[model samples]
Target: MGFKFDWFMKGMLGAVLLAFLWPEPGAKGGFLQPELLNKLGVALVFFLNGLALSLASMKDGALRWRVHLLVQCSTFLLFPLLGVALLWGSAGWMAAPLQIGFFYLCALPSTVSSSVALTIAARGNVAAAVFNATLSSLIGVLLTPLWMAWVLHQSGGNFAVGPVIVDLLLWVVLPLVLGQFSRPLLKDWASRHKGLLQKVDRITILLLVYTSFADTVKEGVWSRYNPLLLLQTVAGCALLFLLVLALTQWGARLLGMPRGDRIASVFCGSKKTLASGVPMAHLIFGANPAIGLILLPIMIYHPLQLLAGGMLAQRWSSAEAAPS
Candidate 1:
């Protein structure tokens, strides 16, 4: 709960460095055949998620309609609009694909693990955090693509939602549904090996990040930019996170949410899932040369959200524990 640096975020940075150094193995047509591995790993990630999901936990959180509405709207609706406004306001500041990356960042769902963890750390409504985070991921499988397709079309790029949705159903939803169906038989094992399953999730995501950045490097996407560009991206991502964080808290207060629900809303509503975003980017963008550039905002935002949310959680926890 204290502001400790997360090793997984460290691993994410290490993955990018590896990709920047030796991109061949993870790049397309490389020895690893990353395209095939990507597809499999992505499906496996979601399948394991379905297996781990507890219906009882979700149900306990499901009845809080007001909390759920606020969280979901903040995640899906508020963030994307912010992306649009940023894109409009910045006009010629960056290239089109990079701008699209910012939009893609906004369009992603709330993260599952960190949001729930931070909520628990802050003595928030963990049940609602779990429900809203999981629901956002599922909804994002559909909405993210639709949002992307519309944006790409507006920019004169072709992104066919129909084909992408069908592919997602096969690789994402089908595996998830199958895992859920098999849960009755395997839930006990999953619970017992929770740490192992979580490692699997992180490994898959790391692999995706490596391959994605590797592809970008192989295509010389980074050559067009400099260190200042990354700094600019970090600043932009930080600003976006702060705005969403403030707005979610404001909305929760306006609704007169309890302390726990407010904590859950602020944490869950403000997160963007690196887990879902990376895999979905690979699926949606499909080997576009600028893939790494497209993911830059999200990769940056992931750690920023964690650090900020973790600090806030610790402060809130201490405040709650203090004698009144």
Candidate 2:
């Protein structure tokens, strides 16, 4: 009935349909060329993301600086540190490429659209959500590469940070800036067509996932990972999500933040953007097909974060309305 449940069901149904329709992993010939389809899908996704973003709403100065700081620290700092620790602990057991993927996932930015959506759904500070989400994207362009380079260097892998930054500018930053600039003209139109825009967003994300998964299947990358290891990685992701959610919520409360700001902090701080993460993966790990395999953890985590945050937001809203 609710949008959250409806979307979750759609995602699950889509994933199922994809798995069944394209059962064979490496069979390439399909309805369309995968590369072109992927590029088109990604473009549409970013465009809708741009439309959904309200730069007008971003001017609100209601954010508690302390809460914002804590969100950034958790998203950019603490998460990566935990990833590094995981890599170290799993060094003897896990494959090198998978380890790199783990680290890469940790370095990604906080999600923009979903974070804002969840925050708003939770009756949180939407403007603060936008600010932090935007800041995370800008910060991620630089920080993700640096963190990746550091991890790779330690692991005796060769990575060029300069090229990565250049690619990021071309692929992520430029488009984002263009979207921001174009928002003024499109904002009113987009508001009137919110349902259409949401449809576009969902379709775009589904296509992106389909292509990325197709690529991984075509490369036989999934074969490298055993079912048990895959299960463990998924379990690890769940635990990490819970830990971050708890930590962010606790940190926000400790900072004496209002309910709205606390919700924004928890939603924005705890989640990573698959939309951003997928594009970055295509740029960074494109040469090594195995690298795409690393994004699986993030893909699994993204939808779960949305569903969980949606439920939590509803609960919080009810609690707030109750007479004490």
CA-only RMSD, every prediction: 1.2, 3.2
lDDT of 2 by residue, 175-245 (tens): 66676677879888888998887777766666555666666666677787676777777777888789888
Q: Which of the numbered candidates is closest to the native, going by highest lDDT? A: 1
Instruction: Give lDDT tens digits, candidate 1, residues 97-161.
Output: 78999999999999998999999999999999999998998899889998899888887887778
lDDT for 105 (candidate 2): 77
Q: After superposition, how far is residue 222 of candidate 1 from its true place, in Å?
A: 0.8
Worst 10 residues of 2 by lDDT: 19-28
Off by over 4 Å in 1: none
Per-model C-alpha lDDT, please? Answer: 0.90, 0.74
User: Looking at candidate 2, what is the lDDT of residue 139?
Assistant: 84
- Which ten residues in a row are the worst by lDDT in model 1? 1-10
